[model samples]
Target: MSLPVHLVPALDGVVVGSTVTVEGDEAHHAVAVRRLRVGESVVLTDGAGTSVTAEVASTGKRVFTAVAADVRRVAAPAPAVVVVQALPKGDRGELAVEVLTEVGVARVVPWAAARSVAVWKGERAAKSLAKWRSTAREAAKQARRPWFPEVDELASTADVVAMLSTASLAVVLHEEASVPLASLALPADGPLVVVVGPEGGLTEEEVAAFTAAGASSVRLGAEVLRTSTAGVAAVAALLARTPRWG
Candidate 1:
């Protein structure tokens, strides 16, 4: 449908065919940024699966109204891909999150690797998390994704291993590994978590820890990739191999 689209926080009990008012930031975006006019169509998403296609009925400074044309409930991709990325130096981590979000990753975890140059400690950790969260939200909107990927707080190797232990398939990217990522067969259902190390790569202890947690240490390719690039590349490869995204 040819309409200006925006995502908003969901209101309770709102359903298909219901006429509703768009308020707050979304309304401002529609009225100011998009310059939407009465009779123009727009799509409003709740970012929790529901997207409502509507035509604008009125527009004002504080509110905008629309008549719902259709509502669609989108199901998240199967075998949800979660990237546990080691915090890269400078803005590379931020860039990695943005790229992964665009690549349709379901969730992201910031890992503090043994050799990580960028550290997220104390209040800095909070700020970093917030930054990544904002990046994910913006990327989701720009990519027209119905749902937003979560940006988790910085975690240590042990913490990440514990988290991924619950996944159906958890793989750690290691340069020395002989098993190719494509060779590792993953379950069609359940989650897939890929842990990527820092520029210096994962320490021997970290690799052993992940392997002990049921994660297979797999090599991405013959050539080594940087910390930020590995997670996104591995995720894309996995997604292509999976039945759902393939």
Candidate 2:
């Protein structure tokens, strides 16, 4: 089995036989909750493409030390994918963030669409963003990803348009669109952005705006996926055609 992975702030200068200390909540989880003991091994990642396989050297109340036996710095994935995911009600937002992270999206931008059933404002907005971010972080660890995906702050429709303008390729998931997502030529590098609407669907004005800003309105297929799932599905399809999945 893969050793339990813990996130660290940084793994700088770590090399073979280097000593690294893990502390606070992360170490407490490994030592107290995971029952990690000296001589056992664990994987530590900075979530920025740096990771180390280290054997535990010592354990304290809320801290531990490990000796790195291996270290790796991976390059980020090519053809980075950025998803403009409209807000979904309840826990679906978290579900979307989790699966999107697991599927290797480079970034997820939470959009407040015109027809969105749930609204994020005041304290709720902060809490919801935190949940999405936390879900992505945990899912990234579960996927053993060297680079964790980012969950951007809630975005306005205008903000999304500004984003689409510079994308290498941008597609808005529209059920009525004639163009299928798979038919589009994939970019070899740079940003490939996919926009997913909310439960009630995208308004005509929203569609026009996105298209005007350089996004192609495309369909996945005959079946319509839920707001929380459509982004990952589209991303999976898009990545399958790119060098990242190849």
Give the number of the best model, judged by TM-score: 2
Write down the lDDT that model 2 would get: 0.94
lDDT of 1 by residue, 30-108 (tens): 7988788999888788777777888889999968998888878878878798999999998998899999999989999
Model 1, residue 125: distance off in Å is 2.1
Give the clash count for each candidate. Answer: 0, 0
Tens-place lDDT per residue, model 2, 132-244, is 99899999999999999989999999999999999999999999999999999876677999999999999999999999999999999999999999999999998888777
The list of candidate 2 runs beyond 4 A from truth reads none
Tell me which residue pairs clash in candidate 1: none
